[model samples]
Target chain A: MTRMFYSLLLLSSLALAEPGTVIRKTDLRDKPFLDAAVVGNVSSNTQVDIQSRKGAWMQVKLPSGQAGWIKLLNVRTSSGTTSSSTALANVIKTGSSGKTVTTGVKGLSAEEIQNARPNLAEVAKMSSYAANSADAQKTAQANQLIAVQVPAFANSTPTTAPGSNIYQERRR
Target chain B: MKKQFLLPFALAAAITASLSAPAHALDLGKLLSGDTLSKGLSVLSNAGEALNTSVKGLTPEQEEALGHNVMANLLGAAPLMNDAKVQRYVNQVGLWVAMQSEQPNLNWRFGVIDTPNINSFAAAGGYILITRGLWDRIRSEAELAAILGHEITHVTQKHHVKALISSKSQQAGSDLISIVADYNSSKSGAKAGEKGGKALSEIFVRGLDKNDEYVADVNGMVLAARAGYNPYALVSVLQLLGSVNASDSTVALLFSTHPSPQERLDNIDQVVGEKLEGYADATENTKRFNQVKR
Candidate 1:
């Protein structure tokens, strides 16, 4: 019964489809793998509804109602709506008022940084919360986080190619 | 030839003396007198040469001190959030991610400032702070690790320190002298603190080079992956940020300081490609994160 409830919960979460746009030309695959059968071809700037994510792929429904998996990075999710609309969407989607609760509270602005005065006391307070290396290791162990040996990428400047697979050469 | 060389030195000395100790300002005439001028020029020339060499790098101790000063100034802008639990949680996550960095032994400290600004800061040494606004937006421990990993790369790469050095080199003599003067005077009064704060603020407001930010993005993913967290957590966070309206005041400073979210995502895609796909199933720790986040 509990498993059924959890499955229902998962379904409810996936029901909230997010809007996204494919930023490049890519193949929509029947399965979430590089060698998977291609179901369709999505061109740059095609709008779609993102259904779910699996590893480096996202399951999305194209405007023509075709559902398939695309490379996650190829699509840009749309959350660029105006604040009021976002707040309204959050209310309907999350069943809560959202960030509007803190609406009137002032946030840090560029001008505040410009005329800031040093607050040494707060800095001192921040120090008291510092975590040591052993403690950090303990936290990692408790969470079953094993350290891995991923290598550094070759340092390069940003280039204009969006779909270029230049990183393949640097992979060990 | 000698006078021509000495003239700029005399002006620098006059300016330095006036700025560092306004009460005992040295006149250009006094600086130009034969014995005094020769001795002062020799000292100033030696100092300028030292500054030139030192501009290439700072000692770890020097970097820590500068970071401390910058952190204090940042606190002045927005004091830390008062919740000890949240502060402690952030530190644990941050230190764990930072341990995967090259400089694992550095004294790492992390905090969440009280402001609602959607941004994070990385000072020279190992100081990292995320604003409450950004903090509230984070969904899981993996996401927090990814963000902290990004800031940690900034420190490990010495992006801010290099920026400071390059900016100092641009001003060469006078600014270097003033900084030394400021350090010496910092021992006695708040005046030096005020001056340092202003200088640090200008850098923070202007933000780092776009290329440096891009480098941090890619390296941050590597760091998170090394720490056994899903590298895609950062992509999710960026997607969330991209969804926010650009004109929102909460993200005003962040948007100005960073490339637009779409641009950053595009750059990450171009750079990282499929290298991190293997680690996508690493720990997300959503349950513990949700429990502690409240």
Candidate 2:
């Protein structure tokens, strides 16, 4: 089963989907090393836009706009997510109108991107990205990671003494 | 036979000598009655009175002189008034009470004696001495007036003369009154015996008998009431004295000389009986005194 999974993962990487591949692991380390800082994690079968590739790593953009390099063999592509080529075409067509296009292939188009600002409205729209898109998954995963890592009350432990100097005087 | 005649003659001459001097050297204890003692006391009362009446007695100048001397001795004994206000307050109260007293004609000097003992005393002259400790404990001007009245009554009633007569008899039996007057009448002899006379005077002040004490208390209440003081001032002063323990020297002296506070208080109740209706309430005095700082 492991051999089959590895073969399928390699095949998906070579025949990258429109955005390249799907996330192969339910979680990924946020840092480069096995011991690197876990800034966030990803879920398996979650599709993300593969913006660029290096020797053994692919830099993918989650719908939440967080981009990081994951092992090439750890993700496969979905056909619908805009590939770098399509993103480049969209930008050039808009730029040909003598209007400013969005900066990168992986970045959003100027008009659509303006509407798809990464805030509450953009994130709530199901049509903005896949229903269970990698970006959404990563956002959810980041939240979960944060929930486990830091307590909501961590900041609530009184940063200032109750009643200020008056409390201190009473204490004395 | 001649030696026998000489012995009889010598014995007869000795008997004659004894008989000749017999009346002059009689024991005062044997000669004076308690009535005579009371009379002699009235005489001493007269001495204090003579300050007003007779020229031979203490003159205003002499009373002032005595007061100055007493005040000097007092200042030496206990320098008073760390606060000018307390001194002024005492003087004010004392002057007011003196105005109401029988001795209003004479200038009464008031003072605070710096002592921890709760004590107050008035001398034969119009010198009133109050101790700070007593002031600290008293609750009202009426109470202070009562204490002063009790002491002043001792002066006004001639308790000292009775005290002196008793003292003289106790010391010299019959010789005291007879020899003392002759000694006082002669300038040279009295001046010669003035040292001894002063010692007896000290005794008179200190050695008051129980009767003198009772008479003083009885008269003190009348005087205090006459002066518009609440009769209860006597009772309240006694109550304050009673609360202090016996080990307190001032309280002991006060209790020793004055009538038992409980009895005096009761006596006041009986004497002032129906008249209690008219006395002014000292509540204002009490309230003013309540926070008086020691």
Candidate 3:
């Protein structure tokens, strides 16, 4: 009975241990072009779930579940992952809502139209920011960030309202 | 034949001695006989002739040299604006407006000085300077054009030249001394040129009359309007002057020399209203202005 209890305890300890624990935070380069090249950036202010480790590089899953190698410093083994995932989900949801309004193309309310103008501006601003950051080789999620932002803004602003189109054209 | 030549030569020598004898001494016949002025200098020849008759001083060469010295000093003191695009743009705008002036003489050179002073001045020989501070504050190109037109008039009318000549005639050696003193002051301010000449130049620059300013204002406004700029730009710029600090004594002097801003506005309103009352709304200059920072 004593031997069986000892064996059971060992098994339970093994079960609790997760595979490939990552203990550093990493940031994905916001520029899509730089996302793949290590020359562009490293894991920014984000932690990762370590899928495996290779020498100095840790192959980990991004918050997006995309796999990439990060320097050891950029990820840490923590419960922050769940909150980050939730935030990401919220971003996607909000972004989709915005995109729906922007792509609606035909009918929009006055408030929606007014709000959409800024959304377009915000999108343009993000694109410009991404371009500059990319040139500087800085890690910026500018495109992703703007992608999330533009739609939410477009939804809030209706493009179908009277005189909005004119304003929109001028702004563009 | 050689004896006849000697007679003329002897007469010329006597003429030269008589002209050099007194401070106001001049051989009027000899001055009129010889075409001492170079080509294109004839525009100023008659005036210089009349001026010599009145003052009876300064040889033709001296007058030419004075004009040349003034122009050289102007060029040396005022460097062209550094920014290529802006410098080019200003020159283009200035030249366009200048072409409309009564006397569009010389290739108009425009530059922005890196000073916070709300001032603009046109030197003899088509040197137009507008301070960056003034340019930045202007809300429209029309205002700039109007101001440029005004400065262009100052140059074309030879206002500074006339002032210099007057000072020389009245004060004799004091004019040269004052010029040296002015140069000294500018040097103390670390400005270009010797302090004395600079001082004289400043004085001369400051001596523009009220009528000259009014004529410039009127002509400038008309030029701007004809150039497709909003005619109201002149009035608007004058009004803007009230908001910004006008501590630059030259700028204040310029305004004082002109009709009051209110007076100018009234004149413009009357003239433009009468002529362009039924005209279409001016095409908004949003596009032209977008290229420039001010």
Per-candidate Cα lDDT values, in order, are 0.71, 0.43, 0.42
The model with the greatest DockQ is: 1
DockQ of 2: 0.00
Q: Which stretches of candidate 2 lie over 4 Å from their true place?
A: A1-172, B1-75, B167-169, B172-212, B226-228, B280-294
Question: In CAPRI terms, where does candidate 1 land?
Answer: acceptable
- Residue B3 Cα positional deviation in candidate 2, in Å, after optimal superposition: 62
The residue-by-residue lDDT of candidate 2 on A56-158, one tens digit each, is 3346667676767665445533222323343334335544544232233331111221122112221112112112223322432332211111111111111
lDDT of 3: 0.42
What is the per-residue lDDT of model 2 for residues B1-294, given as tens digits with 9 covering 90 to 100? 111122122222323443454442233323232343445434544222221121123334433333333233333434453544455455545554454455654555566644444566554556666765566566666667667666676555444434444433344212233333444455444232322223323422354554445445544544545545554455445544544445434344455545565554444343343243234332215333444442
Residue pairs of candidate 2 with colliding backbone atoms: A20-A77, A21-A76, A21-A77, A22-A76, A22-A77, A63-A135, B27-B174, B28-B173, B28-B174, B41-B162
- Model 1 Cα displacement at A101 (Å)? 11
Q: Candidate 1, A138: how far from true, in Å?
A: 1.4
> What TM-score would every model get versus the actual structure?
0.77, 0.44, 0.43
lDDT by residue for model 1 over B1-294, one digit each (tens)?
A: 121222223223434544454332222232233342234333565343333233233566556666777788789988887678789988888898898888998889999987766899998779999987787777778889989998998888776744443322233234445655655444422454455545655667777666667778888899999999888888878887887888777788888888888877877887787879998778876455776765
Best by TM-score: 1
Instruction: Supply fnat for every model shown.
Output: 0.68, 0.00, 0.00
Q: Residue B99 of candidate 1: its Cα lDDT? A: 88
Q: In angstroms, give how far residue B119 of model 1 lies from its true place.
A: 0.5
Arranged by lDDT with the best first, the candidates are 1, 2, 3
